[model samples]
Target chain A: MTRRLSLFNLTSLIFGFAFLYLPILLLVVYSFNASRLVTVWGGFSTQWYGALFRNEALMEAAWVTLRIALLSATLATVLGTLAALALTRYGRFFGRTLFTGMVYAPMVMPEVITGLSLLLFFVAIGLDRGFWTIALAHTTLTMCFVTVVVQSRLMTFDRSLEEAAMDLGAPPLRTFFAVTLPLIAPSIVAGFLLAFTLSLDDLVIASFNTGPGATTLPIKIYSQVRLGLSPEVNAASAILIGIVTLGVVVATLLTKRSAARARRDGH
Target chain B: MAERSLTRKLTASLVPALPYLWLGVFFLVPFLIVLKISLSDPAVAQPPYKPVFDWSDIAGFFSQLDLDNFETLVGDDLYLSATLSSIRIATISTILLLLVGFPVAYAMARAPERHRPLLVALVILPFWTSFLIRIYAWIAILKPEGLLNQGLMALGAISEPLTILNTEWAVYIGIVYAYLPFMVLPLYAALEKMDDTLLEAALDLGSPPWRSFWTITVPLAMPGIIAGSLLCFIPAVGEFVIPDLLGGSETLMIGRQLWSEFFSNRDWPLASAVAILLLIILVVPIVIYRDVEARRLETES
Candidate 1:
């Protein structure tokens, strides 16, 4: 029975990973195709990569997307960390339920609703729907994800170390910065990365909030895709996949090293 | 001493106050604006909708607010059918995600302890990739002259290419592909945390393996099942990119309807009403998720 079950489990993993990965691998492979016809492979070539670089619009959009992601992610991490701190530490504040609702609602709210509503709100307030508007919208949308990530880490945190600091005459604020912050830094970093990726990945919300000058990479890719498939677009997609993979890998390695160092310090 | 302490107190209060104010303005206010826009009449003017409220006459503003857009939603079959189809697609896709996601999550949970983290990371890697890129990858595979057809033809499985692209079937594949991670992650969390000894003990007793799994594993994984379902179902219902990129013109999901109404038709009021109704359908699930999260957090803390 155990043998059969192991076989069953292995089969499930094989099929699932294939389904998950094969499409993406195919996309990356097609990016290297030399033919103008995207479905046909003439030979392996770097022409699309060169074409992608010369596509001024795509490059500009990528720059704008990176800026927006960076700004919004920083803003979200700060606010979300505060919110997480409030949820975990500030027991029974006024309007806690409403605050919690505000935090949680955005995570599951349909992007269209969020997008439309944010657009309406901006118009009503007479805010110009430009780069700043996209940044603010992304910050609001992504903060909840950060809060969830950081809050989980905050829950698992050892409070005795914090208590020990306070017992040794450290002020509450000082102790938090000196002890709590360092311990939870890994989660905050994780939250920031998640928020950054979400900002970069957004289309619908950015679509609604965007104006003439604020075209994001996702918005750009989407319009090109609607026109039809191309190797250049495939190359662009492959590059994005590469960047995200590299970022996640680097982050994992950094976190692992820090954790090991902390473990050694404890011993 | 008093002045110093007062300054410290104010600084202490700043932590929660800042986030609270940010969410109130950017999150809560936008939703209120959506509600207001949903009630107003459509217009050809700038900002698209006439102001229903006048600062001078608040009571008159209340009277001016009418259900014209909502009435149009009820009167027009387009809005009704779009909403129904959206729900239908979301419901079906959610079930498909569960079917595909559960076995994979179970396998990951039952894997060797050292390999579990790597498995979870593998599942999440694709999620980090651009959502547009993932959907675009399928267009290459599903188009009439796409790879799927070529492969099938080469194998002599069919003489002609299957017309899968720009159809509801393509939309299903896109949705199931895009949201698979959302379904699997929570289920993995639940299943991994489960006590395997219980299953072992059940098998050691009179119960068979399958029966023990049905009784012990399935019941314990119920919470994850609900979480994964809500996570996938809610967003899948309002999915715009998948349906637009993959589905035929006849797809008629509410997200696309909302997009067209707002963008193509420039009927902001009607679009707002569509958004409002979508919110209503989603509210129950959103609240349930919040409840689950709150309980989970409470127990953890």
Candidate 2:
């Protein structure tokens, strides 16, 4: 019986890993293929990568995407951290449940609904639908993620450190910056990266909010795929995969190192 | 001490009040706009920007809310079938993910502690890639002269290439492929925390292996299963990219329907109505989850 269970587990492990990795592996391989047809395995060439660089519109979209991601991620992290701190530090108050629910609603709400509502809201407010609108929508969604990550970290935090700083006559703001912020720094960093990745990968919200001139990379990729994909897209996708994988690894390592340092500090 | 007390009072009063104001302005305001628009009449070329509070407009609004949009939805057999098809596709995909994810999660849970991180990384690596690109790659695999068919033909399994692309099967494959990790991670978290001794105890009580698994393991993992199912099902219902990219022209889902209603028909009222219905469907599960979580917290406390 144990042997059968082990065999079942082994099969699932192998199939599951292969299922996840194979398509990505194929995509990476085909990015270097000289042939335009994705199935044909021609000799390796970096020509598509060069083509991707020379595509001016794609470059512009990529730049806009990066700008939006960075700005929105920073804003979302700040607001989310404040929200999380407020929720965790204070006991229940009037409208606390409603506020918590509102904060989380965007996280699980269908992106289509969120995008449509925000689009309508922009139209109603007489705001031109453009990059700033897209950033606002992204921040709304990304802040929820940041709140979740930061809130989890806050839950594990010991409260005495803040009290000690106050007992030593440090101001509340100074105590926050010096003691509390340093303790939750890893979570803050994690939340920022998560927000950045989410903003970068967003297509639905950006699609609804964007004007003609404010195309994001995911929107560009979506339109390109719809118009029938080219190998240049494969090359572009390969670059994105590499950049994100590297970012995740580096962030993970940084957080681990910071956690180790925090343990050593014994505070 | 006086200054400290003053500071604490100030912080207590000011800090918690701020987030509520922020959420009210941004989050709740937009949602309220959606609800207002959903109730507004379509005859008005552009509905009023601010919600109309006049008693006559309010009465007319409620009176005109005669399910015109919903009647249009139900009158069309296509939309009805599409919703059902979407639910079926989502359910199947979720089940497949569970079947495939369970073993991998179990292996990870049972693996040497040192190797656990590596396994978890493998599970998450695909998630970091572009979702569109991942779905697009399936086209290469499922196309008529594609890799899968070609490989199968070469192996003498069949003479004719199978028609796999642009079908319900393709949609299922795409969804399961995309969401399998979501299922695995939560299940792994649950399984890893499980006490193996419970299983051993069941075995020592003369229970068979399957019996022990059903009695001990499955119940212990119910939270993970419920969470994973909700994660997979909700997105699958609203999924636009997968069905669009993989299922092609034949796949009629609510998401694609909503897109067409907005972009093609330009019927904002109908689109808003559809969005409201979708939101209604989602709210039930979300409320249930919150209730369950709150109950669990209360019990734990």
Candidate 3:
């Protein structure tokens, strides 16, 4: 009750971290293994890393994935910020329930369903199933996450600043830009990174919506994996993990810095 | 001044309208398209799906809309069982996740204030990485000569490598492992905000630690448990990568079934129908979550 470090609590903390991190650490280590056998250790080597580069299809998919992620994450952040504002700021509006449902439905809906439904939408509208369509699909899939993240920050936000700005004769839009946006910017950034990761890590939705030459990294890895496990995949996964871990570090740092700054600002 | 006020009002209305229209066309409309496609017949045409409505003749359009795909769902044991089995697997996975996640979350909540952030960050870091990559890591760990089996054999736990790779157990492990972050985050958020004084009072009343835990901790953490459970369970039901990569051919999940129906079998209509059914099944939890969120926001505002 006094919050001393109990043995059971320490055990839980350590084991939980181990369970979460071990498989990943093992994968990273074995990516350098020279063994053709996945589980065996034939000593450390960078040979698989070399092989990963030599694979053209996988590289192309990676390129496609990066582009889609960049475009979609940016678009989703902007739209999600707007949607978050709509949910938080607009007290009531026409079709608010329907709007709210649409925003949240995709979050829980299975990838297969969202992918299938969107693919059909694309077909009906005569939009080609390629990079553009995948980008759009990713945007729709991710904006909900962005909205949830930003809206949480927005909900607890003090409206007095905005009101005070208006009281000082600033227009509503200008006040939003000059005051409110800066306050919630960190969460918006967190939302962007989240959307980017979701887009990059996507397999099922992109698989459904992808056409020839638009294969994403996950789709490429999945196809190869279905064929069989190889060291190249391990290498690819290691690189992916490294990049994303870097991104998450940046996001966490940003969130912490802003939160600290906000505390100072509050004080 | 009146004209400026009108402009400000228009901007206010327009900002919200942007997301509304986007979701309408992209999100909601696609659902309608899926519904229509589900009622149509599969074809060898470019789109591979016949239009449910033949607009050339209104009567023909109505007639073309058939229950054949929906009927196939009822008639086929595979689809029915796939849905049921997916629900069962997801439920069990949620329970396991809660068991593993609750302790970690509680510990994090009870951790020294200086160490809490780092601990929470460690839990979330894995989630930022590619899900496919995480699942791929298991193949190395679960294979016959893989790390887990080899480690067990080395410890004299068993003379042979356990057959865990490409099994339902592996899927369960993968789900819990992957979703552990989702489960822990919400739980931590709840437990961290808990009043330690409540526990102290319970203990002072001569209740044992475990007894106080049941009365104070568990009850207080109920919101977190339910929230974490739904967050993990809902998505796990529709999981594709885990069941596909980890579970063998014998594993029958709706996600896998839907994949094969669309990609392998070339049955777009049925795939759409399968997706529709999954959506319907998930509607209950989604609606409840939406209402809870709105109500929470209402109170916050």
Candidate 4:
């Protein structure tokens, strides 16, 4: 019975993985096609990659996206870490429920609502809907994710260490920076990465918040694809996939090494 | 010296309150702005909406608040149909995600311990890729002359290409592909941590494998199931990009309507009203999720 179960499990994994990967594989393959038509492969060629390089609009969008992602991710990590610390450490406080609602609402809220609401808020506040607006909007959206990720890390943490630090005459702030921060650094990094990717990939929220000068990669791609199929989009997507795959691999290696070092430190 | 100690305690709490204040200003403030906009009259002017409130005439301001947008929302069949279709799409997508995600998550959970991390990584790697690009990939596959049709033709499975792109089916495919990772990860977390002994004992008692799965595994994974369902459903319901990109005009999801209302027609007040209505619809589930999570954490400690 167990043997049959293992076989069943293996078959499920294969089919699931195939479904997950086949579309991506086809996209990557078509990016190399010589023809302007994505379907007909006129033998493998790098012409789309060359075309992608010369696409000034796409490059500019990519640059803007990177800046927005970096700025928002840093802000999100700091705020998220604080929120996580508050919820986990401060216990039941006044308005904790409201604060918790604020954190989780953005996670499940439709991007359209968030984007529209933020746009109106910026307009109401007399703030220009430009690069700064996008950053602020992304930070607000991604911080909730950070709080959730880091809060889980904070929960699993050894409270005894913080107590030890305090008992040894460290200030509460000092304990957080000196001990608690280091222990939760992995989660913070994870949160930051998640936020960065989210900000970079955002279309709807950024669309609502962004103005004339702040086109993002996803927004640019959306408009381009709306007009017609573009091989350049496939090329851009391939590059994005390659970068993310590499980052995931590197992150895994880093996580493995850190976990090993942690195990040694525990011993 | 005593006052100095009081100052330190004040600082301790203030540090944590910074994020709370930031969210209060940016996130909560925005929702309030949406509420305010929804109460105003749509206009043709730049930054179009009218009847700005004056503190001096607070009572007059309250009286000037318009329910026109919300009333029009109720009167218009477009808004009603868009909302219904969005919910329908989201519900069906959630069910499909559960069906596909559960097996993959179950398999990963039961994988050899040494390979579990790698298996989880495989599941998550696609999620890390740009969501837009993943959806873009589907356009290539599902379009009329796309790979899917070519393959079907090669197999002699169809006499001609099936028109999937610009259809609701395409939107479903896009949502399922993009959000699959969100559904699987939580389920995996739940399934992996579950005690295997219960299943082993059930089998030892001669219970059929399928029966043990339903009676033992499904009930225990309920929390993860709910979490995954909410995560996928809420976002999918309001999804603009997928339905706009992959679906036809027939796919009148609220998100796309909200976009056209705001951007194309530039009907800011009406769009704000639609968003406020959508939020009102979604809040019950969000609150329930929050309570479930809060109770779970309380019990964990």
Q: Comparing candidate 1 with candidate 3, which one achieves the higher TM-score?
A: 1
DockQ of each: 0.67, 0.53, 0.76, 0.67
**What's the residue-level lDDT of B79 in candidate 4?**
92
By lDDT, the best candidate is 1
Model 1 Cα lDDT, one tens digit per residue, A1-267: 132349888999999999999999999999999998888878999899999999999999999999999999999999999999998888898999898889899989999999999899999889899899999999999999999999999898788999999999897789989999999999999999999999999999999999989999999999898889989999999999999999999998899899899899982
Estimate, for each residue in A1-267, the C-alpha lDDT of model 3 and write its tens digit.
Answer: 345779999999889999999999999999999999888899999999998899898888889999999999999999999999999888888998898888988998889999998998998988889999999999998999999999999988888999999999898899999999998988898899899999999999999999888989998898888887789999999988888788788777777887798798872
Q: Candidate 1 vs candidate 2: which has greater DockQ? A: 1
Question: What digit string (tens of lDDT, one per residue) describes model 1 on residues B1-301?
Answer: 8997788788778778999999999989888888988888888899889884579998877877889989999999988898899999999999999999999999999888878889999999999999989999999999999999999999999998999999999999999999999999989988988998898899789899889988999999998999899999999989999999999787999999999999899999889999999998888988898787677677667
lDDT of 2 by residue, A194-220 (tens): 899889999888988998789999999
Identify the leading candidate in terms of TM-score. 1
How far residue B276's Cα lies from its native spot in candidate 4, in Å, is 1.3
DockQ-based CAPRI category assigned to the predicted complex of candidate 1: medium
| Per-model C-alpha RMSD | 1.6, 3.0, 1.7, 1.8
**Model 4: per-residue Cα lDDT over A57-133, one tens digit each:** 99999999999999999999999998999999998998998898898888888899989888888888799888999
TM-score of chain A of each: 0.97, 0.95, 0.96, 0.97
Which portions of model 1 miss their true places by more than 4 Å? A1-5
Which residue pairs of candidate 4 clash?
none
In model 2, how large is the Cα lDDT of residue B82?
76
Worst 10 residues of 3 chain A by lDDT: A1-10
Residue A161's lDDT within candidate 4 is 92
lDDT of 3 by residue, B1-301 (tens): 8998898899888878988898999999999989988898889998898864455799877677888999999999998999999999999999999999999999999898988889988988898888889998898898788899889989999997899978899999999999999999989988998998898888888899988988888888887888888888889989999999999888899988999999998899999899988888888887776666666577656
* List of clashing residue pairs for candidate 3: none
Q: How does candidate 4 score on lDDT?
A: 0.89
